[model samples]
Target: MKTLTIRRPDDWHLHLRDGAVLEGVIADTSRHFARAIIMPNLVPPVVTAQDAVAYRDRILTALPQGDRFQPLMTLYLTEGTDPDDVAAAKESGLITAVKLYPAGATTNSHGGVRDIDKAMPVLERMAEIGLPLCVHGEVTTPEVDIFDREAVFIETVLDPLRNRLPELKVTMEHVTTKDGVDYIMGSSGNLAGTITTHHLIINRNAILVGGIRPHYYCLPVAKRENHRLALRAAAASGDKRFFLGTDSAPHVDPLKECGCGCAGIYTSPNTMSCLAHVFEEENALDKLEAFTSLNGPAWYGMAPNEETMTLVRQEQPVSYPSKRDTGAGAITVFDPMFPLHWQVVE
Candidate 1:
């Protein structure tokens, strides 16, 4: 067996839905990741310091025994979010970042910020406090073609925001387009991007090529082959600005199979195996540690975990974890569509 070991990876972006779904999926993430930035787009949304504390408690309760996982909490940025509360959360280390989801952008995102002007109070405070903003990075305007949303948002929303507040650390989460890659690569400071495990492996084809595979559909939806190539190169290039954020969102199978399917792809179960395969294809397996482990910690201003994870390349392909059972429902696992050869050794 060919074995590769590196510092344990962290998920810069992840969604652990509350209650039963949270209980069922927490182990898949905690088993491998030392830490993850838990998204705040809950049903009612985590909007206050008190809410963060309660949510953190629930996450801790859901964590599987013997798993050493830290849930880095975040507050959801809304038109009415309190700036003083945001500053205090950062001061107390109760929250790691603030998430900005444009209203109607994705699942449970209806409460997101619709007017940037209304959110300036919290945002300006984040800039002063040095708390990062993790953005969904897509505009929800009806006229913008779904495929063009990411680029359009960059030209209109993201760039302007960055220019206005250069000190506000920003994490462009689940970046799916070449425009996002180039923009981040060209940034001089206070900017970084998290490339998701699924985005690196699939393109728009996976969603529409063969009669609508809803499981493959996600917000900031996958783009063209050229864009996928850009993401792959950036992730494997060992650039500190690009790192792993699984955005490993899980939705029930029933919800995904319907006409109005939800947007998400659960990847925490086998992200490392999928990543190893991609890095090996690029002939940059040595750089996997940088993308998966090192760069993310550096961007968030935290030290890399002392613990390590190992992947062994087996002669046979790794078994597919087609679906994970959460008490709420059966959540389908993301299928890379190619055989995974690297198995994470316990």
Candidate 2:
């Protein structure tokens, strides 16, 4: 098993922020992932089809020359979203799904849907049109403990929504709990989940144990060891319900190192290598293609990539840069806190 080749993978979830940050990180993702569900949680948010198209165009403009990558755009689902506009976006083939971020859930989510009821017309339309809703599955109430948000979201939000709209397709993005895994597994065909590379590797300990390692911190804040094990098991299980979504969020070093740090891990540069090591460790390398390449496209009703990527296991450790320079500022790369030996050779 010195070398592993699979269909080029797609990131079911990703965040390529606009402007200088977008320019700095787009290539890192395009180098390995063939396509990604581009997140819509920018400053103003891409809340309409026209916004998604413009954002997609900007992404293309920023894409490194000679890199073949597709940006799968999504619209932010605000309370006032126009169903006709949404349906038209889908028909026009410029948008792939709609995103719902509970207001104040994460970065730039202030415009997110506050009342699920208010957004139902849009959700119902999505269900009718067979469009998937990508939800940031966390409750933003002040009383809930940070670690409990994902579980609470499942019990209080997602379950009820699914029961209410059985026909709507949904992806619980960057799921971080055993409860989430169980919920998705116990569900019918309309539901699926994407596991992040960092989530599968780190837990609360990584963020709080030694010191406050801000870089290791992320939304749906990584849970306890048991939850991390659950995520790893789900990903390596070869189940179609689970797939890769790096959630490779990038923030400048200043923002992350300051008093109030942002939540995200910049892992696009090393995700495939880390995943290769993880799958190999689980002795489930045979199923890596399913988790990384095959399952996401299947969920989205698309053909798997014709292009292929080969990862070779070098005897020596692979060295990835600790930080990437965005010119605007430096963005720290995710340190898995373990040596990686696998490299994407082609």
Candidate 3:
């Protein structure tokens, strides 16, 4: 078996829903990642420091026994989010970042900010306090084509915002288009992007080629092949500006399989294996540590994990459960559409 060892990685962006779903899914992440920036888009949304603390408590309580995982809490950015409360949460070391979800952009995001002007106070506070703002990075205007939203967001939203507040550190979460990649690369270091495992592996074609593949559908939905290639290059390029964020948003099987299904790809269970395969295929396995472990912490202004994990690539393909059982319902696992040979030998 071929083996690779590196500092244990942390998912820069993740979503573990509340209650039974959170309990059922937290282990998949805690098993492999040392820490994760938990998404805050819930039913009512985590809008305050108090809400963040409570959510963090639930996440910690739900973690499997003996697991050494940490959940870096985030407050969902809404028009009414309090600036002083956000600064306090960051100062307390409980809130790692604040997430910006454009209103009605994705699942459970109705409470997201509809006007940047209304959110300026909170954004200014975060920038002054050196807290990062993690953005969902898509516009919700009905006229903008879904596939073109990311690029349009750069022109009409992200660029203007950055110009207004260059000191603010921003993470463009789960970027899917080359336009997004190029924009991040050309921008100042204060701006960085997270490339999800699914975005790097599948293109829009995966969702439409052989009938409608709901499991492959995700928000900022997968782009064209060229965009996928761009994402892979960015991930493997050893650029500190880019890192791993699975955006492993999970939905119950029923919710994902019906008419007008939810948008997300559940990838926590086998993200490392899939990532290993991608890096190896790109001949950049040597740089995988930077993409998976080092860069994220560097961008977030934290140290990399002291812990280490080893991955073994055996001749036999790795096997993963087709679906994960949750009290809410059965949730599907991401299938990379190719055999994975690397398994975390924890």
Candidate 4:
């Protein structure tokens, strides 16, 4: 199919870091996605309804003039989070979901939940109110090898939590392993996963095979090639349980290039193009809309976007900027390691 049209996609997960970084990168996503479940892991994190609102306002202010994009706010889940405030945020429609970072799971997550028991009050409240909890589904214990974290998290953390509160809706953000895909596919309800653009395209080899490629490194780091295939199959299967969450995390060049580099891949700029290439390769291009546009909103209890975007495949390879200059520094855009032929018609 040379030309395809679908509803403007919504990113089930995104990170528009606060301040200058946010200002610089907001447009990259806003250009394609209609809405996004904006991640709350800022410098201090958005842990309260007021914080979500303030952060949402900042996102809106940062949006390039005339860009019609919605930032679905979320609270950073902390042990001390007030149930009443979360419920109020829901009632007022100020926040979309609550985020769970297992303290030190990823960047700015040192403030995350250390003990699940300590967070029961908030989690239980969220269950009662039918609010979603987007989890960074990985165990942080030191003994577990980095590549094994996602599978271990499924066995030790996620399964027990789901059994304990079947009513709670949880999005296993950035499912990098087949274990994650199978876990979500086997679930009956209230469990879904978001597949990232880079995970669908690259594996652990992208990071370590040819020296250290910092930009390819991300939390719950890419797994084996077979896992990437599982993710690809799940995404292109038209399964309601899996959808797009670019997880387009941006880290400045210096932070990524240093000895103790950060974990993230910035894919916002060329996500749609990369996705189109993937779906086309899978011979499942017809299912692209379901994965990118329809499933996420339905899972989040909203209607799919009415607006549509058309992608036209051209003979010539499309070119995207390798670096995005933010006020913070130059952030590297994800290199898919292949030429993209699909272009979103402006």
The global C-alpha lDDT for each of the candidates, from Candidate 1 onward, is 0.93, 0.94, 0.94, 0.94
Each model's total of backbone clashes: 0, 0, 0, 0
Candidate 1, superposed: residue stretches over 4 Å from native: none
Residue 135 miss distance in model 2 (angstroms): 0.6
What's every prediction's RMSD, in angstroms? Answer: 0.9, 0.6, 0.8, 0.7
What number of backbone clashes does candidate 2 have, counting pairs of residues 3 or more apart or in separate chains? 0
lDDT per residue for candidate 1 within 1-346, as digits (tens), equals 2899999999999999999999999999999999999999998999999999999999999988878999999999999998998998899999999999999999999999899989988888899889999998999899999999999999999999999989889999989898999999899999999999999999999999969999999988989999999999999999999999999999999999998999999999999999999999999999999998999999999999999999999999999679999899999999998899999996
Q: How does model 4 fare in lDDT?
A: 0.94
Give per-residue CA lDDT, model 4, range 63-129, as digits (tens): 9999999999999999999999999999999999999999999999999999999999999999999
Q: Model 3, range 177-289, lDDT digits (tens) per residue?
A: 99999999998669999999999899999999979999999998998899999999999999999999999999998998999999999999999999999999999999999
lDDT of 2: 0.94
**What TM-score number comes out for model 4?**
0.99
What is the Cα-based lDDT of residue 178 in candidate 2? 95
Q: Spell out the clash pairs found in candidate 2.
A: none
How many residue pairs of model 4 clash at the backbone?
Answer: 0
For model 2, what is the error of residue 18's alpha carbon versus the real structure, in angstroms, after optimal superposition? Answer: 1.1
Question: What's the CA RMSD of model 4 in angstroms?
Answer: 0.7
- What global local distance difference test value does model 3 have? 0.94
